[model samples]
Target: MEGLVKKLNRRNFIRVSAIAGGGFVLGFNFLSSCSPEQRPGQLIDLNAFVKIDTNGEITIMNPNPEVGQGVKTALPILVAEELDVDWKDIRVEQAGLDTNKYTRQVAGGSGSVRESWESFRKVGATARQMLINAAAMGWAVSADTCHTENGMVVHKKSGKKAKYGELVERAATLDVPQEVNLKSNAAFKLIGKRIANVDNQAIVTGQFKYGIDTKREGMLYATIIRPPAFGQLLESLDDTAARKSPGVKQVLKFENKIAVLGQSTWEVLQGAKMVKAEWKDDGILESTTDYSKNLKSVLLNEPKEESRRKDGNVLEAFSSAAKVVELDFEAPFLAHNTMEPMNFFAHVKKDSAELYGPIQTPERTRTRIAELLGIPEEKIAIMMTRMGGGFGRRLMSDFVEEAATVSKLAGNIPVNVIWSRESDMSGGFYRPMYSYKYKAAVDNDNKLIAWHHHSVGVGSSAASGDSFPAGAVANFQVDTEEYKSPVSTAPWRAPTHNFIGFSEQSFIDEIAHKIGKDPVAFRLEMLEQAKNNPIGKVNYNPDRFATVIKKAAEVAEWGKKKAGNVFQGFAAHFSFETYVAEVAELEKQADGKLKLKKIYCVADCGTVVNLSGAETQLEGGIIDGIGHAMYAELTLTKGKPDQTNFNTYRMIRMREVPEVEVHFIQNNEKPTGLGEPGLPPAGPALANAVFAASGVRLKTQPFIKSGLFA
Candidate 1:
């Protein structure tokens, strides 16, 4: 029997069809816009699906990328919750990227669950209503009297019950409901509960396939030799030895790189090593010292551009202040260092291309490939794999484009390009190096009256002018300068907030100590002023920000006296529309060394979809942030990255990770972002804790460089 389909609006549609062996297949188009005239079979834009078998088996398709952020499990739970099905009865599958069907399919910005919360719920609730309506017709009762519970439709008065699978044919014949009532927060059975990640079993068993594991029939492995330095161009190439290498099939040159294709990864790498290439410096060869000096020069002597934000006169306030504090902070570039590295498989045919990989932005990648290959966008198919790690590296499609380019250039054959650890490290696109110069003024009463912030960075500005302490102070000004470097930079995790949070919060902590007030209390006071009486526009919600700060302080015993060796530090930040506060507990060892004891984190990301996933995100973000802030730094030596691999690139060791306790403010407020908000506060909290313990302040990232943490 053919299924019934209905158009809910210009952007959404629902269709129900009968499965071959007596079941129901429900498909929902939640993103793409289509006309009513589009037939159900003709509309291939359905992004989400729910299927039921005669045995009452259930299946759900998750449409977002899974980058260890738990959206793979959390999004499907939204559908399962409203479907009123047993969690064990449902099977989840990852959906490939379909540009015509899904919007916002990329996994960056921590927006998967937050953006799809309401629509995913409607998908399941609408399907449940259809099933209830089908059962009601069979029982000769009103649809309103039929209720669903645990995948069963029941008639309350008549006491007739039918499994959803049994009513598939009837449900398939009914019109799709325009709207369905969603379960209230208290009625949610699976959302807030702690459920294991859907891929846990696969991962633990080593059955999960990452992008690097992709293999296709007769596909050749490729390794590309790229420029050695940031401002270098390929000058010469000799590929005779590379082409004659064992298992090598082809050696091709594209732009400034040489591609070596072979039967295996090892063979391709060997072939690439045999190729002789010469590079010439095309621009200035800059070093880390150059970046620092240039930025400091701009911060000290350059004329400032129009202020990003300004309230009262900052100069006047500073001139009349009883005391003023000035401090300089610096952070170096950082690599994404994803576990899987960069790899993509592409089969570029005459009219179409098939691509498979773990790319964060599939639509954008497809568009770029289409433009490069001179093919229609629809001819390109991208299947996103479960990424071992993305952070923000996969957001760039350079690797995917390389695969497509190699495949097309090598006689239109299938090719899988994989980057070695060194290649991945030196391939550029790192987090920009940043420097902040802050000046604060206080009156005789120790009341902070003015705030002036000047920041300089490579590529882009890392300043959020309207963030916290903006409207709290009477006189505030923020301006930034960008240094045009020959290095590439992209968003890394929380982007600007990652380092800015540390600089701003550490400065706030310093100011609090200078004024003889508790760090937490001082932050709360500023938040109170921003909430009640503000100096300018306040971008963040002061109340929510204050709540997380108070919670973290209370949970960590912020101001409570500790052992003679233990010290605590507090920091709070607002980013990605979520508020987070963290307290770092440190122990001063007998040898004058310090060790991180534990971290207490409190967040207000609104409703938690999956308790386990939410907690895991918070923990992961904290660990990642702490690791980067404490040890990770990517520097340049004559336009070449000084650290190319794990040996040179210092990473926080496992033993160095401290215990983390995560708490969430449970509310029905719309979910914001959880993946990144937890990160921005961790670094500053740890820095503050170090200062409290040693009475020595850290003004630079990779605190080990100070020879204190070492």
Candidate 2:
């Protein structure tokens, strides 16, 4: 049946397509845990696609969009390692969106490398084997007697060597090996090495083309005027002045928005400023004070929905506990604030549409555009551009949709929609504000017996029942409630783990201090219990989690008394299938001000690909985590953001950044996620260190508001 074939094809499949220039093209599916069955008319998955040309040039297509996460460099190294090709001879290219040719092409979730690790290795190994077979046949020798090194196949006994280019013609004719041998861990030459990012030179040289840099022939620049507040809807629009502005071509109104099209970005922006628009409140004009009060009330009351996770009787354990430690934490909504403002280029014709932009979800955006234009899905094409910064902002395609709508409404001419800094800031889809109430029950012996968590947020809950402290406690329960709001919300960085890690780990530290136990030892004891006698389903590897915690503590010299008002704080978390632990060291100045001196991070994301890239990711995540936790906050006043630009919105300065040292646990396991795991623990560690130094328990986010640093 067609359904059966589709289900089986989702597991794994490989296809070799003909090359236009008479060479080889190998496409390997990402999910290879099971054997792939041949199915008619079914397009299977391919995450790693490679091409070998006649001139000995090898090209690897990076399926995932590059949003400065270093997949542009780290992913190709996976293929190059197993393909046995010289790194200098390989070319890396950004792949276009093609559902048939690639799967999981979108960039989000920190899953690009994690999903492609095994399949990409198989891709390179399969191609290498095909070339070996061709060489062995040409030499009249057994395939087992041939080996590949540096893009050449050699007949071991005869010492006959042939470059990959020389054998590509014959290799293309050979049947693909059903099972290919992957190189051992020791065989890797390019994976673990420190390799610079593929686009580093281009970025530093100002040659990189981001989405905002997109330009096309005869393309008109446009700016849109949207409602100033969340609950407001456009009631009236007067664009007569905008139409008469210099270089202004047309001013069109579509769906509560006024678009001013002109020859230049400046002209369009100036024209947009001339447009008059009136808005009316469509619903409740929610403010930060209202959100905070409502969320806190939800946390205090019983959730309307069923409990997310319930284990042994938490009520009974709490009733019989010797002491109950309870704490409530609050976090404000956060904007993505990508360096480059939102921009997209679109041209919708009668039957086809062309889109180019920095989008994390390209295929989804393309499909949406097709539906919006009433065109067939096959007629829409999208080209993904390197983003200045995504941080989960590009996952939404509002800007892309606006571009297509503007183009279609403007005589189907090419149009590029650009948003100013204020427009980008006011545009919704921010990280939802969250409030968490954590309770831990301890017995007379100071043993943690029960854990209960209640979370309330604007849109959805950011708590994972399977994360740490779940299986560690004998009785555990998690309850969550979502509050309806007019403001849009989307994932920011680690998403659920960002706030959960901070609140949960900080509570754990509080409990440890209450029981008079060292933080690191207390966590180790909990992990040991989870490993040996877990209460329920343990989704994380307890040993791996404990390893990073211990490593971080050791590296930071945890619990050792430091001279001159210095204190260290430790926190560990498991997120995105990666284990990360961070230690923050803070010192109090003579003036009684706290200074973040340094941060030590230990991560176990399995085999490191591109050591330089991994370190950069870890360090960047740490800095971002510390910066947001310390100074970033977004508030709403009458449903409009109080801070529209950097002038009012605060960010951590470079001078305030502490020295960060990253230590990666070396191992041979399959690589996991690295982009987000390093972030979750950074905030909690720094907050705990601040508490240790100032003897003040800060429960809210944007630590600057606490005035501890001052």
Candidate 3:
């Protein structure tokens, strides 16, 4: 029976619990599409996601990692609103990975809010309906006469009211409500309202605990010495000196690296520095400082290429064009540099294991640790901690694997692995460096007729032309050439959009300048064409895209002069089912350096769950984008990362961040991604603004800050 319960399809998974004193606890499988029989404590399952205690307090579980994206607060607001419960009456709790009960717990690609919207609403509404039914049963009245408000059920004419705590017992007896009514958009109170983050007070007071703060009784700290470069392995290690270091407990050598365990983190750090290891190159990759040259070589002579998208006749359109604009753009690899670095705690035993850490993909973490420790997935328990930052870095469980391996090798005692700042930065899994070639054709009348884009990288897609300006042009072609590398890479923030948005929008701005039109007007013209006579199946809504573009321009007062030598640049993009437009304002200093003055962002993500949180995400993304464009890059030599710490890898200083204003389009469209959509356009807008202020066409990334205004 337990095995069957664990194997039940997502839809068939349901859990119910009775409170000690009075109320009922219900765990709604938001991902479940089918209804199953309600089982209360007969089979094993996870604790409930939604619980009503005997005191009428509501506890809602947020399945996704907070990762500083505010899903912790935003998702619970979603449930509380639909449940018709007062927001203040609900306490949000972080849920651990439980594949049998909670699927889709991973947080990446700005999908946490977008994916959980419908199901969480259902979870809340279903619980509310159950409470209403329970009240209706207890009052001996038709359920139709009962409605829920402020955590209580009211009988309209009978003048009888019952708290949720008093009605839970009856609710438990009733069958689970298969269908429940959802609140109308106009009725949403807690969702759209600006509510403070649940952890804001804790965060401000330095009482909030992150993965770095995790500790256990008798836990040993382990520090690893990995290869300085990729394609290298440890040939020999002399850890005898390390074991003799102060507070050093043990020194273990592995196939690829060495680990030093000590009584304290300080001891582990000192002991790790004392260990000596020699690495032998595998000869898989050679040392190189020029990524741009390598990327261009791949694009020029790649034997195989894929045309991601093609429409009309690109060659013929270019041949008949009165003018052609062509350019090349490249962006370097980027490190995640999460605030807390990568750390995890594990206690692996022969039959079972316990793990805790800050990770975005928790279920995958459990599965991978199980495979590594040779334990049943069910026997391995994973506890999630607050992450200082994710930005897609925590999506990988390599840190967890290291901790589990250390624990297993050390007699299955609890081990906490902590990566130093240098180690975390040098560790691979960076944002892949990418390069692109863009060609645009315009007639004598300045009407765009053709577009061609070729991108080269390990993760580059040939179909980038399919993003924006796809259906807007009659002739569009995108070709992709891939280059394999020994270095590891993964999605960073908006992934491809992070670089694609800058290249595409910057080229569009160049075309608009040559055609003697305002940048904003040029995009609006293309959006108009896409709306009226699109060349192909346009995946985006033309109206929404155009709306945000126009709104951003209006708010920024495009073409209007501000105080001092300020210039404005405009760009817009659509990604993750959301539309965003940004206008960046720049001021030139007396010394010919550029200073960001302000940024205006307008978004159409559809029915924002938390307005304040949404705005903060946009603001953060804009600054992050600016920081990367101005000073962030990861170079490689011999398949190894060059940047090792914040000293070398630049971050946006507090003073460097500019004032930002955010506005959202109001509609009932389902909420889309907020984390990434705002990021893609920021780079282009800032680049365009740099051109406006400095009269330099910045084609490369990290913008060569010193030469920008030379």
Candidate 4:
């Protein structure tokens, strides 16, 4: 961490770039240190990080990624409230993922909103004060009498005002202001308003371009074919017939794979079909399920260590308990079926390279591609676009590396490598299949006295990057073993929140049933202990947690019974300092299956920014989470993924989507994460509702396939 400012504000304003021929046209930047030439009575482009364009437009840039959670809308609302800008004119853009701009670019762990509140407001206030200073200088009057409104400078005595647009170039010349006053939440206008997403217009229309849409001229499209089984290598490839395919240009054979490069996407596919290729697994191909079995034994019996916390003794309490309850939960691997498949377009011309695509981690992708290509990081230019849907799939850099390799093989020409829908599904970068084993014991009054929870899976950081180690419970232990897989894994929505919601919440339910206590009351009791009890350094805001639970219960009418087929199941979880509670309604249909009716979601993820965006995330999360619960799994046969595409891998569809109603508590606090916080609770909530209706406790995932309904 350097004390000194690295450089003056530069107008290298990052914005959406329309692909031009084979490369993007670079722009001129503005970075000046002189007093701005701003009009005497206009909004100032203060030395602060936030700035307003003269056209009454507002732009706020910071470190957070907008992976469909509406960071662009939520974050700017925090600054626009203080900067005195019209909501219509505000334009939120991605800040350079620089340490100078944002301390942490890693978009997981739910730290987005909690980490940036003070820093973002400072940026806005600094700009506002500069406008005031510039106004007083022009009016030859004391700055105290001047007031700012709608990006204009107002002088009461003289009845004089100036538009901010008139101050653009002048504000660009001013020194960065050192001090500025920020508005309190009491004076805010947009903080609690139900604004829609700022980027929605570009998204809904066909004009919204994703990384997969990035195009380059004189560029080739490529597709790679690898060994069908995991740990297999390319024995050999004969491309004699492939080179003759229409539009086919070249066929390349890497160590273990073959790539077909051509002038069009169609040509690449055509050539790939003619290439003769087979894999030699080197004798490492084994059943993915078999490896998972080995991993389970490793976690359960392999000398587990206590990586987290313990507030009380468990051995004595469990021994004396009048009752004990136990259950094991299992979840299979999940795929992030983003609408637009993974795609990246890269062009390397001798020394410098250009890349355009949908990138969640632009800086990381740049570094990785540069390293692989033996180029300086600065020599690479990266541009990003709105995603069809990311769900943590775009966080990895391998797709970018593949594009770079294809571009190099195709010579200096820019190449766009678009992964076909089949390619995206078959190529393995997925949410790891997971499982959890739990044990709990209760005292004479049915109060929970002792508990032990252990989770087993691949690539799950039950306690990796976050401040809270998995051991957040008393007399508790968590063990995770990364089950070996040929497929790589990245963070899926809510990450371990998926498994935690199941194991922790379900155990709570089982305990309630064993003790003859109401589920909600039982949860409240546990939360009372959770409030006073410390669970390591990781944050768990007790008050907010209670708020969502109470709010959800009140709205869902927990005590009321909807007779007939509809049954209600309630669940609540806290992650990323945000709390979400959901009540799922289920109906046992004539076909002997669970049918979802309606889901009520109440969330307190701190403050709400984009009402539509927040609700959309809630609605989408429930559907996706429920989809996994009802019908989605990746079964393995001899170390190979058996499910190939959407035909076999079903998702919750139009008929399956339940009527969803989401209510956000109006709070003055700054925003927390909205994207993933809503996903974890949906699963347990849905499962709970199903149990209420069927009298069956479904512990295994893809519950339908587990024979609960069958």
Error of 4 at 404 (Å): 1.1
Cα deviation at 193, candidate 4, in Å, is 2.2
Sort the candidates on TM-score, descending order.
2, 1, 3, 4
* Candidate 2 off by > 4 Å: 1-20, 30-46
- Better-scoring candidate (lDDT), 3 or 4: 3
User: Residue 410 lDDT in model 1?
Assistant: 96
TM-score for each of the candidates: 0.95, 0.96, 0.94, 0.88
* Whole-model lDDT values for every prediction: 0.86, 0.87, 0.82, 0.68
Give per-residue lDDT, candidate 3, residue 211: 76
lDDT, candidate 2, residue 24?
Answer: 83
Residue 126 displacement in candidate 1 (angstroms): 0.5
What's every prediction's RMSD, in angstroms? 4.6, 4.2, 5.3, 6.9
lDDT of 3 by residue, 1-710 (tens): 01011122335436566667666666655334432222331111122367887678889987777899998898888778877888888898888877766765777877777766666776677788888998887778998888888989999898898888887777877887655677878877798889999999999999988877778898999988989997788888888888899999989876587889988889999999988888888876544445577778866753366577889998999999999999888888889988898999999988999989899888878888877777899999888888898888898988899999999998889999999999999974888888888899999999999998888875445235459999999999888776676677887898788889999999999999888988999999999999999987698999999999989988988987787888988889998889999999888888888778889999999988988899999999998888898889888777777789998898888988889999999998878888878888988998999888877778877875557532
lDDT of 2 by residue, 1-710 (tens): 01011112323655554577668888855444542342342223337888998779999988788998999888889889889999999999998888877775778888788767766777788788889999999989999989999999998788899999989989988776767777777768898999988888888999888878878898999998888999789888888898899999999999878899999999999999898888999978989999999899888788788888898999999999999999999999999999998999999999999999889899888889888999998999988888888999999989999999999999999999999989898875899999999999999999999999999889877688888988999999998888888899999999888889899999999999899999899999999999999988898999999999999988888888887889888889998889999999998888988889999999999999889999999999999999999999999998999988999888889999999999999998878888888899989999899888887877899998887795
Compared with the true structure, what per-residue lDDT tens digits does model 1 show for residues 1-710? 22223335523664546566777776666554432222221111225567777778888987788888988899889889989999998999888877544555778787777777766777788789889988888888899988888989988888889998788788878887765788888888998999999999989999988889888888999998989889899989999998899999999999888899999999999999999999999978999999999989999874467788989999999999998988899989999999888999999999999999898888888999999999999989999899988988998999999999999999999999999999999984899999999999999998899999999889888687887899999999999878887898998999889999999999998998888988888988888888899887888888888899889989998778986779998889898779999999999888888888899999999989999999989999999999999999998999999999999999989999999999999888867788888899899999999999899889999988766663
For model 4 the local lDDT of residue 73 reads 73
